[model samples]
Target chain A: MKSIFGKSKELEKNIEEYLDIVEEALLIFERDINRYLEGQYDLFEENLDDILTVENNADDILKEIKYKLYTYMLIPEARGDVLNIIESLDNEVDLCKKVLMQFSIEKPEIKDFIVSDFKELTKQSLKSAEQLVRGIRTYFEEISMVNEYVNKVHFYEHEADKLEERIKRKVFSTDHINDLCKKVHIRHFSEKLAYFSDLAEEISEILSVASIKRSI
Target chain B: MTSFLFISSGLFLGWSLGANDAANLFGTAVSTKMVKFSTAAVIISIFVTIGAVFGGTGTTETLGALGSVNALAGAFVVALAAGVTVYLMTCYELPVSTTQSIVGAIIGWNLFSGRPTQLDVLYKILGTWVFSPILSALFAIVFFKIAEYIVKNCRIHLFKIDMFTRIGLILVGAFGAYSLGANNIANVMGVFTKTSILASLQIGFITLSNTQVLFLLGGLAISVGVFTYSKRVMSTVGRNIFKISPVASLVVVLSSSVVLFIFASEGLESILLNLGLPTIPLVPVSGSQAVVGAVIGIGLAKGGRNVNYKLLGKIGLGWVLTPLFALIISYIVLFFMQNVFMQQVYF
Candidate 1:
C-alpha cells in the first residue's frame, strides 16, 4: 500500500514537472521574441537554445508520465483524458519552440510602430498558454476551479486574436516598409505567435469536457 | 452418505446464491477494471466464509421460525424448489431474490406437511422484503451526500482520489461480501439446519455447532459458485445494468452492504436494545434489490434523472411472481419426493 501511494506521488511529481517545463518554454518564447524585436540577437539566440532544451525535457517527462500511468494503472477512469491534456499541452510547447526557430531563420525586419503590437501579441498568446497550464493543474486538484482558468484562457486568446488583426492591418497599410513580401512575412510571424492562443483555447475546451466527465 | 446426498440440493442452492449475489458486491469494481476478478473472487470467498461461520445465526433463526422443514427429504425438496425457481427467473432475465424464493418454498413445505405456517413470522419476513430496499435507498442518499461534500470540499488531487477510490472498492467489497454471506446464507442452508446431522467439531479454540458446520458447507458452495459462474454475471451487471461511475458504484455497494449488515447482525440488534433504541429485525433480504435501490437513490440524488421506471416496474412484478413460482414448484417436488421416491418427506 505504501508503494502504491509512492508510485502515485512519483507520477504526480512527473506531471508537475512536465507542466513546469511547458510553462518555462512559453516564458522563454516571450522573452526571446522581445529580445529579437529589441535587436538583442545574442540574448535571443541564447533563449532559443534554452526553450529547445525545455521543450525536449517536456517531451521526455510526458513519455515517462504516460508509461507510468499505463503501467501502474493509476486513474484508470481519467487516464485517457489526462493523456490527451498532456499531449495537447506538449503541442503548445512545440509551438513556442517553432515560433522562436522561425524568428531566428527568417529574421523578419520590423518597423518601430509594429514592434509594440508584436510584443503585445507575444505577451497575450503566452498568457493564454500559461492560463491553460493553470486550468490543467486545477483539473487535477480542484475540478470546480478549472472552469475559471478555462475562461481566462479564452479571454486571453481573444485578446491575442485582436492584437494579431491589428498587427496585420498596420503592416499592410503603413508605408514604413515598401516590400509586399516583407509585409506578408511579418504577418506570418504574427499569425504564428497568435496561433499559441488558438492552441491554448482548443486545449482548454478539451479540459472543460474532461473535467465534466470526471465530476463524480 | 445419505445425509450428504440429501444435502446436495441445499448445496446447489448455495451455489446459485453465490453465483448470482457475488455480482452485487464486486460487479462494478471488476467490470470497470478497477479491481481484478481474481482478487475479488479470493476476497469474497474468504470474507463470506468467515461471515457465514461467525455471524449467520440471527437470520438463520428467523428463517427457522418461519418453517422448520424437519425431515431431510423435505428440506431437500424445499431448497431444490427455491434453487430451480431462482435459476429459471435468472434465465428469463428477471430480478429474483433467493430470500423470497426460499421463504415461499418453506411456506409450501408447511402446507404439504399439514403444519400451520407461522403468520407473524411470515408477515415479518414479507415486510422486510419491502423495507430492506427502501432502507438501502435511504442509506445511499445519506452516504452519497457525505461523499459528494467530501469530494467538493477536500481539494484532493484527481490521481489521489482515484487511488483512494480503488482501495475503497476493495475494502468495501469485502464488507459487502461478508454481509451478503451473513444475511443470505439462511436462504441456502436455513432449511438444512433443522435436519443437519453433522456433529460439533473442535477447531483450535473454537467449537463449531452442527448448524455452523452446515453454514460452512453452504459458504464453501457459495465460494464455488463465485469462482465458476460469477464473472459473466458481474460483467452483465457492471456494464449493462447500472452504468454508474466508479465512485457511485462504491456508494451503492456501501449502502447495500450496510442494509444487509443491519438486518443480519445480531450484535447490532443487541447493541441497539442495550441503548434502548428501536432494533432492526433480523431477516434475510434481497441483495439484488438493495443494489437496485441504491442505484435509484443515486439517481434521485442527481435530481431524479434516468431512474429507469420500466425496470423498477419489472422488479416490482418480480417481487410477486418469483415466490408464487417457487411455491408451486415446492409443492410439486415435495409430492414426488414422498410418493414416487418413497421417501418420508415430512413427519
Candidate 2:
C-alpha cells in the first residue's frame, strides 16, 4: 500500500511539472503574439525564439512522463490511450514550435485580432493542460471543466481559421507582387501555426475518450 | 509713423512668406495621394503654427545678424522687397525659399548703403546655397534607400507594410515640422531682434524673451498665411515637382530637411573654411531650392534622363529672377510712393 501511494505521489508530481511547462510555453507565446500585434517585428522574432525554446523544453517533459507511464503500466483502463494523449500534447507544442520557427524565418506580420485570438488559444491550451493533469491525478470532479476548456480551444481555433482565410484571400488577390513568393511563404507559415488549434481539439477528443473508457 | 509702418509691413511680409512656404511641409504628401489636400492643408497649418510658436529660434538670430538694419526705413524696405519677391515667385509657380528671398532682399538692401557687409559673413551665407541642396539630396537618396531596403527585405506581410509606411510617414512629417520650426522661426523674428521691439516686456510673472516674442509673432503670421494665401503655392508645388511617389516624396522631404539643418548648424562656415572652401555663415537657406535640388539629385541617382529638364530650367530661372524683380518692384514702389504720391518728404 505504501509503494502504491509512493507511485501515485510520483505521478502527481510529474503531472504538476507538465502543467508548469505548458503554462510557461503559453506565457512566451502570448508575449510573441502581442509583440507581433504591436508591429515590433524584430521583437516578435525574438519572442518567437524564446517560445520555440520553451516548446522544446515542454516536449522533453511530455516525453519523460510518457516513458514513466509506460514503465509503471499505470492507469490500466486508460493504458492504451496514454501514449496517444502524451503524443497529442507534445504535438501541440511541436506545432507551436514549427509555427514560431517559420515566424522567425519569414517574420510575418500578424493582425491585432488574429494575435488576440492566438493569445486566447494559448490561454485555453494552458487551461486544458492543467485540467488534463488534474483529471489524471484522481481529481474526477475537475474533469468536467476539461470539456469546457477544450470546447473553448476548439471555438477559438474555428475563429482563427476564418480570420486566416480572410487574410489568405486578400493576400492571394493582391497584385502588388508579380509572383507569389512572399504570399506563399507567409500563408504556409500561418497555416502551420494554425495547426495548433486542431492539435488542441485532438487533445480534448483523446481526453474525452480516456474519461469515457475509464468509466466503462 | 515709422514704427507703425515698419511693424505692419514686416508683419504683412511675414504672413505672405508663411502662406507661400507652409505648403512645402505638406505638398508632396498631398500630391502623392498619401494624404488628401484638405488634410494636408489643415495639418500643415496647425503644425506650422505650433512649430513657429514653439520652435523658430536659430534662423531668427541669423536673419537679424545677416546685415545691419540701422533705420526704421531700412526694415521697411527689406520687408517690401521680400514681400514683392515672394508674390512674384508665387505668380511664376516657382517654389523659392521665403528665407532666401528675405536674406537676399536684406543683402540687396544692405548693398544700397555704403556699409559693406563683412565678406566673411557674406561668403558664409552664400556657401549654404551651394551645399544645402547637394547634402540634402545625398541624405535623401541614402535614407530612401534604407527605408526601401527594409520594406522589401523584412518579409513583413503586405498589409503590415502599408500600415508601417503610413506610420513612418507620420514620423517623417513630425521631423519635417520640427526642422521647419527650428530653421524658419528665425525668418519672422529677426527684424524684431534688430529693432529691439518687445525687448523687456513682462506679463503676469512670465518675462517674454526675444525668442519667445518672435515665436508668438511667427505663429500668428504663419496662421494668417495658412488661412489666406497657402492654397495657390501648395497647388503649384504639388503639380510641378515630378509625379511624386510616396518613397520619392519621403526622400525629397527628408533630404531637403537634412540640407536645411546643415545650413542652419553653428560653425558650419568654419567647417567649410577648414575644408578650404568658402564658408557660408548661418544664412537662411531656401527650403524650396533645397527640395528641388534634392529631387533633381534623386532623379540623377536614378539616372539623369529620369528628370524633366524643361520644368527644372523654368524653376531655376524663377529662382534667379524672383529677388531681382522683387527688388525692382519695391525699388520702384518706394520711389513712386515717396516722389510722385506725396509732396512731403517722409524719410
Candidate 3:
C-alpha cells in the first residue's frame, strides 16, 4: 500500500530548484570567464557577489532536500537510490560554487590562445549537467526514457574529457608561461571543470542501477 | 445430538477457520485498503459456500479417512475439541493447525473405539502435511521468476503495470479464497459428513443431503469468523507480514492455492490414474503453512537474507505440539462425554 513513487514528485521539485541555482551560478561563471578573457578585471570582480548569492541559495535548497530525505520515510525500495542521486548532484553543485569562489580569491591569468578552449570546456561541462537534469526528470515523470537521457549525459561527459585533455596539454606546452604554479593552476581549473562531467557520468550510472533495482 | 444447537460446535471450527485462514485469501487486498472489509467478507462468504458445495466433497473424503466420527455426538465433540485446542494454542502465541487437531482427535476416537486407522491412507495424508510447504515454496520460486520475466520483457508503462497488478492481485486473491474454502471445508465438514441426526432438504425438483447442508452451515460459520475475528488479525500482524509487491503477493496467493488444490483434488488424481500415471493422493494440508512457505520462497529468491528462520523454528515447534495437545484433549473430552454425560461416542 505504501507506494514507491509517493515522494518522487517532492524530490523532483527539490532537485529542480537545486539545479536551477546551479544553472544561474554557471551563467555567472560564463560572464566572469568572458570578462577575464576580454581584459575587464574590475567588472569580473563586481559580478563575484552575485554568483556567491546564487550558490548560497543552492546550498540552502540542498540542505532542505537532505533533511527531507533523511527524516521522511518515503518509499523504502527507492529511498536509498534517491539519496544517492541527491548526494551526487549536491557534490557537483558544491564544486560549481567552489570553482567560482576560486576565481574570485585567486584570479588566474587567461591566455587568448586558450579562451576558445575555456568556452568550449564550460559549454561541455554545462551540457553534462543539462543531460543529467533531463535524465533525472525522466526518472520521475516517465522512467522508461531514463536510459536515453542518461546516455546523453555519458556522451557529454566523454566530450568534456577530450576538452580537458586538450586544455591541460596546451597549458603545459605554452613557452611564454614558465611558472609551474601558474601552469598547475590552469590545469587544476580545467580538472575542476572536468569534475562536473565526471559527476554527471556517475549520476547516469547510479540512475541505471536504481532503475534495475526498482524493476526487481 | 439430535438438536440443531449441537451443529454450533462445527460452526465454531468454521469460525476459527475464518479467523486464522481467511487472511491468506484477502489479506493483501484488505491490508492495502484496496478492498473494503465488508466487501471482502461478502465476496469470500459467498464464494466459500459455492466452493464448498461444489468442490468441497473431494477433500472431505480424504479427511473422512483420517477421522470419520459417524455418531452426531462424536462429530460435535471432535470439532469442538479441535476448535478449543486451536484457540488455546493461538492465545499462547503458538501456530496451530486445525487439520492437525482434527486428525489428532480422530486418531483419539480410533484408539478409544478400538478400530484401526488405515495406515496407508493416514501415511499419505501425513505425507501431504510434510510436503505441502515444500511444494508451495517451489511453486513460488517458479512463479516469481515468471513474474520478473514479464516485467522485464514487456514494454508496458509503469502506471499501467501498477494498475494491472492491483486488479490481478484482487482477482487471484478471490480465486485463492475460493480454493481455500473448497479444500478446507474438509477439515470443518469431514466429521459431520456421516452425522446421522440431521434430515436432508428437498425443494421440489432438487434435493440436498444432510452432509451438504452441514457444509453450508460450516461455510457460514467461517464467514462469521472472517467478519468478526479475522479482521483483527488482518489489521495487525497480517498487515506487516503482507507488505510485499503485487508480484510477490500474487506469487504467495497462487502458490498457496496450487498446493491446497493439488493435495485435495480427486479429479486430478483420477485423470492421472486414467493416463496410467501415479495418481496424486487426496489429502488436506494446512493453508497457513502453505502461505508461510510461499513467503519463504520469495524470500529465498530475493537472496534468502530476509527469511526469519527463528520464527519459522517456533512455528515448526507449534506444528509438532498442535496435534499432541488436541489428541490428548479430545481423548479426555471423549472419555468425559461417554462416562459422565452418558453419551454414545461410538457404536
Candidate 4:
C-alpha cells in the first residue's frame, strides 16, 4: 500500500522501524513465558535476562521520538498527540522489563487462563500499535481510525483486570503459594504488568481525546 | 548651481533613514520571522520615500530655518556638516539623529554667520532632552500594556490574531513614514529655500515649485540614506533591545511619531514657555531620542521584566553625547577646511 504519511517517506520509515523493535521485544516476552509454562525454566530465565537490554533499545527510540516531536512543532498541523502516546509506549516497555526481572529472579507459577489473558493483552497492544501508526499517517485524512486503537486498549484493560482476579484467586488457593517470598514476588510481577496495561489504556484514551480535538 | 549637492545630501539622508528607521517599522516582524529582511527593507524604503516626497515639507522647514544663516555657502556647510555627522554616527553604530545632527550643524553655521547662539532656542531644544523620552515612554508603556492585554484577554484564534496584528503593523509603519516626511523632509529642502536656491532652478519654460523640488529632493535623500547607510542601526534597533513582537514595535513607532509631531509644531516652545517652563522652539530635537522614549514606554508597559535596562543605559549615553560630538567634529572640520590654506583655493 502507498504510505499514508502525506509526502515524506522519512516519517513512515521512522514509525515502522520503531514498531518492529517493539514487536520483536513483545514476541520474545511471549516465547519466554511460554517456555516457562512448558517447565523449561532455564530457557525462560535466559530470555528474561535478555529483556533488560530491550529497555536500553526502547530508550534510544524514545530519544528519536523526542527529536521528531520537536521537529513537528515547526511543521504545520503536526498533531502533538504522538509525543504523549510514544512516551507512554516507552513507559510500558520499561514496566515490561521490571516484570521480566521479577520473573527471572523468582520463578512464579501463573495459571493457564491468566497466561492466555496476558497473551491477549499483548495482542491488543500490538493491535493498538498498528492502529496508532496508521492513524498518525491518516491524521489529516480519515481521523476516525484512532477510535479503534482506543477501543482495543480499553478492551485489553478489562481483560487484564479479569486475568488479575483469576491469578490472585489461584495463588491463594494453591498450596505452592504457601511459600511467602514466591507469593510476594508473584503479586509484584502481576501488579506491575497490570499497571503497564493501565498506563497503555490511559495513553490510548488521551490519544482519543487528541484525535477528537484534531478532527474538530 | 550647487543644487546637485543639496539633492545628493537629501538622498543620503533618505537612504540612511531607511537603513536605520525601517527596523523601527519592521524590526520585530523580521526578527520573529513574520517577514524577511529584504521584504521589510524594500517596503519601508518605498513608503518612507513616498512619505518624504508628499508629506515632508513641515520638517524640512523646521530644520532648514531653525537657526538663521543667510548665505548659500553657509547653507551648504550646514547640510555638509549634518551629513558628515550622521555618517560618522552610523559608522560608529550609535543611535544618533539626522535631525539633531542638522540642527547642530546649523548652529555651527549660524555662529559662522555672526549670529551668536540663540540660548533660548538652544535651551528649549535641550529641555526636550528630558521631556520627550519621558513622555514618549509613558505613553508607549500605556499603549503597549493595553495592546498586550487585548491580545491576551480576547478569546481570538492565534492565526487571526496574528493577521490582525500584522495589519496593525502595516498601518503603524505607514504612519511612521508619514511622520518622517512631515517632520524631517524639511531638513533637505529648508536650506535650499532659505538660500533662494529653489527659485533659481529652471527647466525649459517650466519652473519647479519649491514644494515640488523639496518633495523630490527629500524623497531621494531619505532613499539614499536607507539604501546606503541604514543597515547597522536597523539591526541594532531590531536586535539590541528585547525581542519585541510586531504589534509592540508598531505601537512604539506610532507613539514616538506622535510625541515628535507635538514637539515639531511651531507653538511647542511657546506653549512650554507659557506653562512657565523655559523652552526653545526654533531648534528641533532628535527623533532618535523620541523613538527611544517611545520604546521605553512600550518596555514599561511590558512591565519591568521585559525592558532591557542595560540597552537603555547604553542608548542614553549615546543620546547625551551625540550633539557634543557633532559640534566638536563640525568645529574641527570647518576650522581646518575654512582656514588660511583651503579657503584661498575654494574662495
TM-score of chain B of each: 0.98, 0.81, 0.94, 0.80
Candidate of highest DockQ: 1
For TM-score, candidate 2 versus 4, the one ahead is 4
TM-score of model 4 vs. true structure: 0.59
Worst 10 residues of 2 chain B by lDDT: B155-164
Instruction: Write candidate 4's Cα lDDT for B164-255 as tens digits.
Output: 55556666666666566556666555665555556434659755566656666666666665556555556666777535555667677778
**Residue range with the least summed lDDT across 10 consecutive positions in model 4 chain A:** A71-80
The list of candidate 2 runs beyond 4 A from truth reads: A1-216, B1-5, B31-33, B36-57, B199-207, B265-280, B311-319, B330-347
Off by over 4 Å in 1: none
Candidate 4 chain B: worst 10 consecutive residues by lDDT?
A: B338-347
B278-313: candidate 3 lDDT, tens digit per residue? 977767778888888888888888889788676577
Residue A13 C-alpha lDDT in model 3 = 71
Best by lDDT: 1
lDDT string, candidate 3, A1-216, tens digits? 424354445655776787677777667777776676677889977777787688678778878777766554333335568778767776776776788778767877778888789878888887888788777666654666789988888888999999999988998999978899998988888888788888889888998887765554
**lDDT (Cα, tens digit) per residue for candidate 2, span B1-347:** 55655656667766875676666766656554545556665565566656565545555656656665655555666677777777777677666666656666666655554355567765666666666766777786687677656644554432233334444555566566556655676665565556655555476987767657756666677667766777666666677764555556667877877666555555565678789997445566777777777787777766665675764675557556765665565455545545675522122
Model 3's CAPRI class is incorrect
Better of 1 and 4 by lDDT: 1
lDDT scores of the candidates, listed in order: 0.90, 0.60, 0.76, 0.60
**Where does candidate 3 stray beyond 4 Å?**
A1-215, B34-36, B202-207
Report the lDDT tens digits of candidate 4 across residue range A85-197: 66766665666676666666666666554566555544544444444444444432345566766676677667666666666676666775567666666666666556655
Residue B294 alpha-carbon offset, candidate 1, angstroms: 0.9
